[model samples]
Target: MHIQSCGTAIDVNFKDVGSDRDELLQATKKILQKQLVGQSYRLIILQHILPDTVTFLRMARNAGINVAKVFAKPNSIHKPSLETLVDEGFAVSCLDYGEMEGTEVLDKAILQEHALAVQYQEQLVCVDVGGYFCEPLRRLSPKKLPNFKGVVEVTTFGHNRYSAKVKYLAHPVISLAKSPLKNAEALIVGESATLATDLILRENGYLFVGSKVGVLGFGAIGHSTAKALRSKGHLVTVFDTDPIKRVAAKLEGFGVSSSKQDLLGNCDFVFSATATRAVEVADLKHFQNGLVLVSVGSKANEFDIDGLVDAAETAAIDSDGISCLTYAGGTKLKVLRMGKAVNFHVQSCPDEVMDLVFAETVACMATLSTDLPKSVLSELSDESRKEIAAKWLQRGTYERN
Candidate 1:
């Protein structure tokens, strides 16, 4: 598909592996260019990343689209870019809560769509990540908003899980899966994740240095978790189904376990870093007593939470705010924030780190609005990496800009 945007034309051949991530980003830009024509479309952005969203809003201005309004968290509305976008006639409003907490904004955005359906018809498009934005929009009664057009759920989570759910919602819901630059952000954000985990462990009175720690999965999160635990003087062991990853971990000066059973059999604390079901009921059977299982991923599907509940003789939160599941065999498993992403659940990530993460997402979104080939997943081109890095390095401090 050939898309022409702002006098620049690019051929989008998703099937062609030769097309790098830059071209894919160009494809996204082209799509947005086409969609935002004649100041007719109302592009409602639930703004998270200030700088990147401003960058996209400028593109919207150049495209002549009506930059209706941007909804951001309450205290996150003071950025210079945000002021620039607002000064340029874009309505920038504040949503209640912090960057990660935008549920109220989702509600208000959907309510705005009701009037927009009657007034604007098909010219309305909402860009949201968490299912919160689209789910309610999808549920809006057709009787009220008969002209409601569609929604685009950007893949904020591991995969495009929300896309399938909204497919049956009777609207053209676009699910853009993992962004190309996700791993790059993952590597950088690992610092905050490590900090959150360390703080949580310490708050619960768990000794870090002397503990036998096992890191499950060898992806970005897994590798970072292992490195962080090792740095804290813990005896860290790595386990993964992939032999190459296990070998890589071994080369990093860490012990490699033959299987999940082996890791479970030896560790005092184990971190589930993979999105998959790395620790199943079968594997839990081999878990050492009084094991601490801190999952640094989402609460859903990362581990077998239901299975853990089923096998446990008692499930309760301890006095120190840690979740504990005691099994019939006198073995107990402790989880952080009930298996949610420890960093996110704790909200321990500093504002600047989240800004960087959100900025990366914005850059990816600028490149994702178009149709991308299903084969290629996450990536960061040299130019794109430099651009993101330049932004990161430019901001020397974590002040609310």
Candidate 2:
């Protein structure tokens, strides 16, 4: 409770008046300062935003990362989308990774842990609403690696600890209980919850109820995406590497499959969220034309975009005199952003549902703690507004040194 030099206090109030989002954000700041050992922590986080990184930072703190005294750069990972926050001097000041090597505060072990975790699993899905792994090595505490041992999974029934990172997922709940027809038509498959949900919604609009759909990867987001598809009257087909999970989906009234070619060739929509880098890349040749290929993996290597780029017309948006898309036919694809990245919470204008979920999740995870210094979860409630605010500002004060 008495974390020192960790900046501000961190505590979220999901229910109350006069208690706003600033309290949540502050909570996050304090925890990160404590866990990552700011004085020596050197890490570089690259992202459009820092919410997910922030979330994981909080989770690390809960696992025992001493954020305040040990890790350096209290605000390195706290690069706020808000121009005001950036201007207010809360952003992580940039440093030369070339210069800050061989220091005791800087831990080569940090990268070693991530490398080990990545090596531990065939595939790893690193999720962050706020920070990146690099920040720990480059700016925070270089003296140590993240406290991987503190990371654990605690459900309502029990708890389980994992050596790998992805095992500490974001969440696992979805609502597909809209109507009886939702159950009648069910099929689920996609690489990520966002993409699976998007494609399944489209599939339900086109396919009739009771249509068998196959879902690959039933992780936290995957399950929700599949459930949403199931609600729209398409049958969800479950296929995954996890035995317990694969069987669970089967028990939940879904057909399970093991072969990628066999499953995609047959299902109306092959939504995949398997949490791997190249999910269906090499094996994508098996998918037939008009197969409605879509990817939602956080890392865009899930599908062979190079192959699909020639098959469709793309939409164009000129950014600073740069053409962002290419129009082919009716398929609104981005030749520039070929990867079908859809923010489920912010799919449309003025939508922050995902951001809210992201902030809440991080807040809860940060309170938990880690061995290495880690940050606490703070509410970035106004991330959308902050994003817009940043649009008007030029590049951050950081000019490569």
Candidate 3:
């Protein structure tokens, strides 16, 4: 199969299970040699890269289609195969934390800024996909905003979660980044840096080596959190109702707990990144004494904040963004960011990481540069995805490895 768009072309050759591995590489090489775009391309492998996959990547690089990046989780790349790819001159920019984008919020310090009303008389307000627009929009309104004429919604994915809350604003709304790719963009850019940065900040300053960490969910955010914690030498245990996710975690060599109680009871630091209500008042009873509860997900209710406030004998925010609380049971806990995303609250995300995500969102917005779409959501052309990738690469946030 072949696909061409955005100044690059992709040619794919599928190999069935038990198919001749040598044959597959040769077939892929022939396709690669036929197409020369004068620029390197990434080989995105969703699953583990077997010997056959490495051979294909190596051959493609020889054909001038250098593997400038490897678009897969770090775990998916077999170490020996990765060694070969690196030895064969592949750049291999793994699209894990390195390609993540959500940390832009911390670099921009959007949280520290007092909510400013939209001052545009008739200008466009583009809420790019960086999860940085919500707090800013809270201060915007027709009455409060100075010279605010209308809003040009550059992205639609934010509507369900953000724009809906600000519907009282009279500005005309124009949703543009509605493409299915936008959702993919969100997945790539939203949680990636947030999880990495949060873990980095906490581990560097607070979480000592070999600390016991419990992750509340096993979804994208939770998975990334667990991976980051594990990388920092923490004994990470994951809690999720989804047996498949639990099994997947176990397969990856991480500890998995079937019950939330098990995770909360055993770990010293518990992070809630489930993107939903994972902990309630009753569950709080299971929390180990002096457990550090940090909410890394953006959404509220992940910790039953109201319940935490009600159950705590004393709750107060510290200068470092930690919420110190004493429960009625006398279990003292330090909740990061008032149970909000810790990175945003502390504004501790590294600047380079934020640049990558901001670059991608800007590139995604540029795809809608032409005539405005009347549709609620639109499709992202292959060109746009390629552009996002290029812009992200151009940002130079993550080095080639």
Candidate 4:
């Protein structure tokens, strides 16, 4: 196979190297090497600090890409992976998701990239999660730094951010979040999150089966989680701000709540998968006693933990480190995993499942070198994603057979 990008022609090949995790990653690396060859952009990657991410970064470097800087969400930083990244000479930083309502951490990274661009005379590219780089990239002063090539946004939340700023951007923005390939990954992530919640509840001496579960948001993750919970013999109710989603849930045979208050008032447990502040401090009053709140999204902002802490008359931590917030009149709610994504409390997904998205992400980097429409949010071509999927299916089927 041959792919031409950045005015350079490169030969590409995909061969079965076995179907194990390492083998698949090696194959992915070979594909990236051919696609990204002859590119000289300084890449800034923002993703979870995981073993798989370590493999991806190492492969990018091996494929002749300059990985200038790496950043991770504060809660998603895995110690072993952090150590590995640092040991391998990758400049890394953890972004603060604190009380401040600004993009200071991301701003720092942007400044660093600007400096590197001046020093190295290379165009800049960013791979962002959750739209952290959206504003920073848009805010770039062309006079000071005109070498920004583009960005690849990986999450729906981030894609939303980029879309809002599309009119103001000066560089191309490629979104994988809206791709059909990512919808497949979202379903697997949803299942993993539900299983993780079940395991945590069981570990804490609670029976998940008997509890009435509610899912906030009817997006892909939320929809899949509701189905997974129902399959586990739990009655599932869902609430979404969108009427279409509510109707879809009702049609799917799941109870639909008309309002957030009704859902919180009724369910024994709730999964906040909206990727926004689904539960606020004012809404805290609606929570029934003994309600367990589980966050399934990437960030802790799914529920306003700070607001809950301030509103609580008293807070207590159990032996398992679960925090119980007690409001007036004896209403208590327990937050699991300290309001972070519970699925990542261990691993987010099996390596094989994550490999599909990771492969697509690497392939998308090659698009940065191509002439894409500037200042707009676009998806990688269907043909490109199909090609990656076909390769994945071939290796997976071969392994299984």
Candidate 5:
């Protein structure tokens, strides 16, 4: 089969590596690979280097897909897995979150990908984590970058970014951020974040039990985290800018804060799951003494770390992995994982849970390889998700039996 785009056609001849139903990732790979057997495309993925991600990449390669480049987030790169990718002959690059802004890193990557596409005459498909490719790709002329096919965005944050640029997009985007598969993963992520926070606090000689905890967002992760914390004996209050989410929290029996200030003032520890800058530098004044800030999302943008550092009289990391920022007025704020995702500091999502997301991502890639509407946003069909879920269930049952 030949998938034609931009006056170029690539022949796809993927042979079915028979189903390995006992292993989840392998089983998922087999099921999803059926969609790509008659399609071909090169992939450039921007993702964290977690164990599941490493497994996903190997699965993609085994399915006869050419993984051109993988841009690993610096904050979430697992060293051993990264070395494995290097040794396996996968072209890998790590993004520097400190020296370069997220979009800047994405822009540079897109440019390099454009060059590769032009030179190799292969259609390019970008798998984005944080919507980093949306704006930069929107600005590019289609005539100059013809080999670019589309993107598969996998985060709610990234989906929002692409949604904003939907009208101006120059290529198709398959969003799995808000898909049911991702929603399932978010539940596990939320539970993992809560556990990691507790473990980190204990390691730092702080008891989170009986503490007043506040969740800064009432999204899926926030809601799950709040419930998990409350179950573990923490007083959990929830806050959100969205009135609907605030109402949802209230209806769900969580103590809803009237304002961010109220939540900040009342809670001993605040978990920012807003995916954006939930707490800014100016909000530091409302911070009470000995308040700990935890970022539940992947990026450091959850809390303004640079602003906090600049405003602090002294910033230092103790023997524990926590960073303490002492303000001039004597308020000390402790940050876990230096404002990166705490769940990542521990194990990310469990391997089985993340396999669902990875499988969905691969399915999205297969969908992108087909001829689709251009310069618009799309999603994996319900039929596709159901198919993946069915395979997952089959694998799980087989493992148990």
Candidate 6:
């Protein structure tokens, strides 16, 4: 066992199992028993998709914290694989796709500590730059957002969870920059950097050089996605806003699309990373009827494909319903109906996002020193450095709380 500080969060890295988890849990229980003072907290998040069952609930339980109500979104990028805490008698809410569209009052339940379901809105808003549904909440008219706090997601589809409650938030650069990959290769762009990296470097018996690939939106994820495509010797084209970004993309040997429609009839695979209205619903018609588009940004609104891939068409009510899609390319274009649109958001899990989220949450839960243990920050001393490392790690995989 070891203990150290990596800034505001505590990292208790232990090699022991079974007994170790129990011991740590016991230790955590004792700590929380005193900290609670007496009130519970609402731990609202999409967990359980990671390899290790995310232990927020366990941590909360150990802390003697009552989980007000768990937001078990059915349309989550990754639903609980292990037994959800909700399933085990915890107050879990299986959110409907329609409800998840921002149609319901997520905040009402999230903030109220144990409030039961109430009247929901016609639409809910979802922001997943790394999930299957880019436009997760495109169908409803929600009660106007009162302020930014309730509008934005505290945690994105990715594990980059930073709380708005903190005014002077510490930047986690070093943690994000570390190369988690065993053997690092060229970096890939796209919010779902994991899948993009895997697809580019892995020798799965596929051609790369001269392969036509289109990456829509030249944002952070877009640039990364394009770079990965190029690393494998494939020809890549980039389209996005921000002229400077476009210029930078051009410098990288990518063909920048002046307009969303510019992508038509020029590529085989189109990866949309920009959530702007241009590349979203309106751009669906611009594809050459057989274009394959994958989104790792925002909700899956890159295409106006309601009937094409809605829950009704995919029959997501049954098990594994979330991985469904409606192909827009039709028959000839349909021959290439691939798996879940190369969605890393849905494919990644609680384990993947928790390390970052836990670190952030702990940083908020405790402090950089007094509350945070030294063990967690041992990997990097500075929070900014850690974030940089995390950025590097984005292209690969890592494990931890």
Please tell me which predicted candidate would have the highest lDDT against the true structure.
5
In angstroms, the error of model 6 at 298 is 6.3
Query: Per TM-score, what order, best first?
Result: 5, 4, 1, 6, 3, 2
Better of 4 and 5 by lDDT: 5
Worst 10 residues of 4 by lDDT: 1-10
Candidate lDDT values, in order: 0.56, 0.36, 0.49, 0.74, 0.76, 0.39
What candidate 3 gets wrong by more than 4 Å, as runs, is 1-125, 128-207, 241-244, 298-301, 315-321, 345-352, 366-379, 391-401
Give per-model TM-scores: 0.60, 0.45, 0.49, 0.88, 0.88, 0.55
Residue 66 lDDT, candidate 2, scale 0-100:
28
Candidate 6 regions exceeding 4 Å error are 1-40, 46-48, 63-65, 77-82, 111-209, 276-285, 307-341, 345-354, 364-401
State which candidate, 5 or 6, has the greater TM-score. Answer: 5
Give me the displacement of residue 86 in model 4, in angstroms.
1.6
- For candidate 1, which ten residues in a row score worst on lDDT? 1-10
Write model 5 residue lDDT over 1-401, tens digit each, in one string: 01111111111121211233226574566665687675556788988776567778878888777798887765676665666677688887764654234456666666777787778666678998888787777777777767777888888788888888788987789988678877777787788788888887787787777889999998878877888888888888999999999999989888999999988888899998887778889898788789999888666679888888899999996422689989987889998878877877566576677777888887877776665744488888899899888887776433533
In model 2, which range of ten residues has the least summed lDDT? 154-163
Which residue runs does candidate 4 get wrong by more than 4 Å? 1-21, 98-105, 118-121, 318-321, 396-401
Q: What RMSD does model 5 have?
A: 7.7
Name the 10 consecutive residues with the lowest summed lDDT in model 3. Answer: 1-10
Candidate 3 TM-score versus the reference? 0.49
* Native-to-model Cα distance after best TM-score fit, residue 279 in candidate 5, in Å: 0.5
**Which digits, one per residue and each the tens of the lDDT, describe model 6 over residues 204-313?**
43333466778777755566678766776777887776788889988877888786677755776677665433344344455565455565543334544443344222
Sorted on lDDT, highest at the top, how do the candidates line up? 5, 4, 1, 3, 6, 2
Minimum summed lDDT over a 10-residue window in model 5 is located at 1-10
User: Please, what are the lDDT tens digits per residue for candidate 4 over residues 1-401?
Assistant: 01111111111121212223365464476558667767777888888776777777877787777898887666666665666677788887664654112846666666777688768777677888887776676777656667776788888778877888888876678888868777776787788787777777777787677669999999978988888888888899999999999999999999999899999999999998887778988887788888989888677778888788888899875422368888888899999876877766556665566667777777777776666544367888888888877777766432533
- Candidate 2 or 6, higher TM-score? 6
Which lDDT tens digits does candidate 3 get at residues 152-232? 333333344445555443333333344433334334333443453455457547544678888877765577677777876
